[model samples]
Target chain A: MATRAPKTKRGTARRETLLRSAERVIGEKGFAAASIADITRDCGAALGTFYIYFTSKEDVFRELVGMMGSLTRRMMTEAVQDAPNRLEAERLGLRAFLAFVAERPSLYRIVEEARFVDPDAYRAYFTGFASAYATHLEKAVAKGDIRPGDAEVRAWALMGMAKSLGDRFVMAAEKPDLDRVTDEAFAMIRDGLAPGGAA
Target chain B: MATRAPKTKRGTARRETLLRSAERVIGEKGFAAASIADITRDCGAALGTFYIYFTSKEDVFRELVGMMGSLTRRMMTEAVQDAPNRLEAERLGLRAFLAFVAERPSLYRIVEEARFVDPDAYRAYFTGFASAYATHLEKAVAKGDIRPGDAEVRAWALMGMAKSLGDRFVMAAEKPDLDRVTDEAFAMIRDGLAPGGAA
Candidate 1:
């Protein structure tokens, strides 16, 4: 579906409203169950107004997934921008990621659901993230800020760790403690589970 | 959907065939797109015969998810049974998981799809596995087999690592090298990425 870019400020604001509403509705009801009418209704817009911004439900869902990808990348970048080193960056990045999941859980679930709703977009999201992550690891290795290993493997492994921790601690927890979870996971990431471990 | 257990040997065999077929059909086409007729057709069973064991497509999908949970637990247990220490068990277990993903990519996708199709089953499956994993970590900590940390957090983090690695290396890769992926990730899980890392 072809999504049109709004020309005027009002149109831009209206499109943003529809996108936000679509995120909430699609995130709650999922892609298959959520309807265009539901999205418009949720945003207090007429049914035809949805067509002004998006062509179909699939188009809006894909846009949401794309939005999530860029949002996550931007969040992580800003979160870790001031980290002193690669290891600190990992800690900062993981903490930021968990907090992001806690704050915008609807968008998180929507991105996950994209695995089935839009497989290509889903693959692109993670693949793009992983590639950028691998580059960072490579830089960290060159600087000797962290141990040398397979950057690609390490990047994916760390991403997995953060993703799982976010799901368990933030998404699934009754009372999420971002600080405690971040500290423990960061400890493991830095020193690992090796015997006579570093504190 | 209420699924009936097969009482006779022939009934059990037939049920198993239907289940195996369901795993493939659902895994390939996904739960929403896959139908009972496709499952029956794949298994060479009559349309009416599906009702012999499973009441509906949802029933069969749930059964497959359940089967994956038990099968994974069994596989992990057997894979790590002979490990001399917790660290070794981690390596063996990860290696086994990647191999399992490569062997049964269908069932792997099926379990993931369960997250949406049957939310309760999906939660139960991961919660059960994470609990068992946490227990193992507790034991390992008590034995001084690895450095002590939050068992639950570690369990989920490690599970996430293995899962993401499986997705990237085994599921997404056209040419997967389970041993190398296992080795690299195991190194991180063991010694971490601290400067002057122990390899």
Candidate 2:
């Protein structure tokens, strides 16, 4: 049993190391340019070891996409839950998204590139997040806190604004003021989707 | 002069053919993978002929970005002007954007990839369109037709929403009902930004 615990820990460590290597390669070279050789070399792992964990480069990319989606969703959900009201939830969601992009730009790049790598995977990843946000929007709409429409579409639009702004201004630019950008983006969302006329 | 006219016509024809070839090659092979040689070969042009018009592959890409930005902005401006009111202008802008993407999927792909190819070029290209839209939004805000705020930021959010939906759903998916999808997107924007809860 003691031996089994060490083996399992090593496997987990190996998986994480591979993921980090993949993120670095993808971020620098983009999804199309990133090759298995580059990833294996970065990880200082044999090709055989990489294959043992990931079926193929594409498989590794899909796993990366899934991992990023789950991590971002979890973080945003936790942040939203910590908020006191729907408005705060919305603001926190935007901030959490920016923080996620800032913290793991490589992971964020991989997730965005998944659109080109596999549109279905990209859709699946976004659909999960959209559904979660849609549920939140639906509740707010039910409470007459926000205008009613297609909550799913609204959620996507809201998320898209945050994602685009974060990618364009924060990730693409160096030395961006995160606090000001986040505040401006959050204010835009709040005013754009406020319960009634401009608050 | 009459003899020179045919030569000018041929030059224009060759340029158009080269642009079309670049679009196809870049669409299939991506910007980084699509070589000038591939583009020239596809266009049935000599190596020297390629440099006569463009200094480098990057030059062609820059021209393409400029062309697309101008085309999109022109279409959007026309649509907004054709609209009878501010609300209609918003709807028309959404429809115009969807229509442009639907008609030029390859161009859209090229423009999107430009973000990865050259950040400055990408910003310049998008900022052109953003500024144009912001002008329109500023007009509406000045007329007390829409809520007052930073028109530039509002324009970015609107464009971001349209782009995200276009890339995620319309262009990514085959045989998407563009009209319906566009209407759904516009509905959200209309509801979210409509003055005095008019939507």
Residue A142 Cα positional deviation in candidate 1, in Å, after optimal superposition: 0.8
Once model 2 is optimally superposed onto the true structure by TM-score, how far is the C-alpha of residue A114 displaced, in angstroms?
2.1
Candidate 1 structure quality by residue, lDDT tens digits, B9-45: 9999999999999999999999999999999999899
lDDT of 1: 0.92
Taking chain A by itself, what TM-score does each prediction score?
Answer: 0.98, 0.89
**Residue B161 displacement (Å), model 2:** 0.3
Clashing pairs in 1: none
Tens-digit lDDT track of model 2 for B117-157 = 76677889888777777787788767767666666667777
Candidate 1 local lDDT, A1-199, one digit each (tens): 6798999999999999999999999888888889999999998999999898888888998999999999999999999999999999999999999999999999999988888889999999999999999999999989999888899999889888898898889988999999999999988899888888465
The candidate maximizing TM-score is 1
Off by over 4 Å in 1: none
Give the worst 10-residue stretch by lDDT in candidate 2 chain B.
B1-10
iRMSD value for model 1: 1.1
Residue A43 local lDDT, model 1? 84
